[model samples]
Target: MRAEFFIKSFCRIENGQVMFNGNTIFTTESEIFSNFSKETYRHFEISYPKFFKMDNLSKLAFLAAEIILKNENLDADKNNIALVFSNRASSLDTDRKHQKSIENSGSIFPSPAVFVYTLPNICLGEISIRHRLYSENSFFIFEKFNAEHLQLYAHNLLRTKKAEKVLCGWVEFDGDDYKAFLYLVEKNAEIPHTVQKIESLYYNE
Candidate 1:
């Protein structure tokens, strides 16, 4: 029989609030995605100087990963954790910025800093880089959150010994709207990793 897996830790960062494992650990009144993310970073005292340079999608994903992994004592050489993240917009927010920079007739050229984040999977790289997790990782774009797909992907990774633990969820930032929901999956944890539970956690049920 395949060993069961559980959601060891989860994080939700959206609507100007940050929740860890179903508890509101930090709250901000600012509705602007940039301001809220920066404030939350400062409030949490996350020690990453490069965080300020990341695009909004990366910022949201980074914050969610930071909240859950701070207590994890992450190994610099850890290669057992896998990352599977999905988003609806596929870096449209940053793509727009890149476009604007390119279309600016007054400017000579587009900003290279902003141009680097045109791909949605770049956020996954950001999280992986920060956590030092050199494991199998993939980023998918869906019309909406596909909980069933996520459950299946994580399960396969865990069962096949590709990863001892998996970090999976949705992180999206499109224009001024943004949201993030991340969970860590492993054996012998509190909540079973299932489609129903994933939908409930995402929908706040």
Candidate 2:
């Protein structure tokens, strides 16, 4: 395959700073969690909506994705974009609640509202719907954060031409840490089609 795109652009979090095009965009006190709602805090360190909302992940993903898209100035609906994400705790919060409902013994009916968020993939559904990105989507879970999984899945999508572009990374919210990072990769002039070595990029030590 030929290199179709060179990274004319890049953004990253490093050295306690978010560097974009060599400029700092935003930073916050680590104590920002002090101001979140109680339920948000329980599920995600004081997030909005207080209680578990099946849509919460979508909301967060949308904001994060939109931030990247706006900074890169890419239009979501126009691009044939895909979203691939992996997380350590896939809907563990909702799973706990659903089990509680059944375990109540007396109350045999699980609330359909709470039961819905138990799936690991619904977050991706939420994001795709919000962005109107009716393209490829996937969600994976691992014991811990693994950049190798993220990179390989993304590279395979591009390699197989399942999508011309992809938005991929990690997003997990529980207790106090609501961390997310995403990159938009598109077929272009700089990067050519070849073996995408995720191990070297993520596991070089």
Q: How many clashing pairs does model 2 include? A: 16
What lDDT does each candidate get? 0.90, 0.57
Off by over 4 Å in 2: 1-52, 71-77, 101-105, 189-205
Please report the TM-score between candidate 2 and the true structure: 0.65
> Per-residue lDDT of 1-205 in model 2, one digit per residue for the tens?
5554322333333222333434555444344333322222343233334233543444445445645655544465575678887778777756776778888855656588777777868877766665567779988887876766665676788789888777776666554455555556666645332225222222221
Locate the minimum summed-lDDT window of 10 residues in model 1: 101-110
Instruction: Please provide, for model 1 over 73-101, each residue's C-alpha lDDT reduced to its tens digit, 9 standing for 90 to 100.
Output: 87787657899999899989888888788
Best by lDDT: 1
